[model samples]
Target: MTVQNILSIPPYHYVHVLDLNSNVQTLVLGPKSYVCKEHERFTCEPKRMISLSPTEYCVIRNPVVTENGVPVVDSDGQVRLRMGECEYRFHQDSFPLYPNEEMSGGVEVLPVVLADSALRLKARCDHVDTDGTERKAGDEWLFEGPGEQTGSSSHINCSSVRCTEISRSRLLQCFIDYLQFETRGIHIFAIKNLSIF
Candidate 1:
């Protein structure tokens, strides 16, 4: 049957199939592809088949070590993964697997909208400085909003901060009000405001 004809039927849309040779291919059947009872007939006995969501992505990593072409485990009993790359399987996108390549996990990117607020980030792992100084984890950073920030790779904790919106006129009035207070006969003094959004 034609791809359009197959897709028109119930429970058929798209399928990602891994062949016996470990080659991965994606068959686009329709817009809303998923795993269903009818997938086996179209898969032709693949090693594995899964349904991919357009909003989600997978991480492909090359094993750090291998024995006889199989991935080797580290002392911690976990496969050592390095040189990670992302696979964005938007409709009909195929993921070809290389030798000793494995998928780490799938991730779905969620949208966050911050209005009149800021995003606070804390490092979860120790960061090594250029001079060999280890900046311990828990180091905090801020992304001021009403703006857009893109992170390519992040392993941190995130929290939202509601900013205190003060108009320019109100800020100036507060400064003037503070100056009116007794200051040991000092007429002029420096005013410093060190508040993070």
Candidate 2:
């Protein structure tokens, strides 16, 4: 059966399968799935951002098809990723996966670079699929925008801000603010070794 036949399955996660020896490429949808909730990774409040650690990685979802200069939604009313000759379709319920395209789309995954790591602090809205699943934002489903530009001056600015201003108390407040809205799931910002000398 073709992809269209099997694509209807709700909440599909695409795993790229590649065999270097044979140069065979295939897309496998599967065992991994996610359902978002308001109080899970984030709250319903606007402008409330999440902070990410350096080790954290995020998956992004592209809301529109941008094969053309202008973006248009796919016929299936789902997300599409065109990487070379192969085009991948995803159910609207899919949380986040990086789009392998050269141009910038309306939606994007986070930590565009180490420089915009601060952008992780920006809060985003949760996605509700047609089936009524609430999709929370995380490294997988983060929507990163054109944040701090990369260059010499930006590097200096980011470094200065990190070194001079960020404090444990401030971080705690940020985490507390985030927690106020979360009703279920573990707190994303749990301070393990926080202490005073």
Candidate 3:
């Protein structure tokens, strides 16, 4: 992506050497500030809980670009989760996600993980199952796709006999639908729910 396209996302971080015309850097995101390569060399952070789709949960303006890093580094050298972008000689920073902010938009992922671990982990919505076979309540699904779990592609991870990846639009719609019907409990289908967990 071009530098401008990358900066489209709100809240970023950057370097702040004002005197150095050639060695200056900046970002344009949350709590954004400047870093000086000559004096205060700061790194950039991008948005973490972003509205990937143009759904209803999104509050901030869609900048058309976004970035995030796990175990992110700060200007003071502290290891924290971070997301940001660069502006004209400035850096933007975003509100970090708690260890349990996976359901940022109220829709919980049942089969995949957005991100996890001491290092870094991120999962993107792939698709949904419209023809899901109804099952009894309290069914536990073994997640084996992203996150700390892995399974052979041939082995289906959910109750569904088939696994398929859909477009981003479908993924977003599934998340929206889930938030509407799901009651934050265990269910049998393609996925399950966790308790604020």
lDDT (Cα atoms) of all candidates against the true structure:
0.43, 0.31, 0.29
lDDT of 1 by residue, 93-160 (tens): 44334334556665444334377776765555676644464445655555556654433233343777
lDDT of 2 by residue, 53-164 (tens): 4333222333335666344445543335543332222223333232232222333232343332332222133555344646454312122233422211001112221212
Number of the top TM-score candidate: 1
**Top-lDDT candidate index:** 1
Cα displacement (Å) at residue 170, model 3: 38
Local lDDT at 176 for model 2 = 31
Ranked candidates (TM-score, high to low): 1, 3, 2
Stretches > 4 Å off in candidate 2: 1-13, 16-28, 32-73, 76-157, 161-197
Write the residue-wise lDDT of candidate 3 on 48-74 in tens digits: 433322112221211212246344434
What TM-score should be assigned to candidate 1? 0.34
- Model 2 clash count equals 5
Residue 108 shift from truth in candidate 1, angstroms: 1.4
**Cα misplacement distance, residue 132 of candidate 2 (Å):** 30
Clashes of each: 0, 5, 30
Whole-model lDDT, model 2: 0.31
Clashing pairs in 1: none
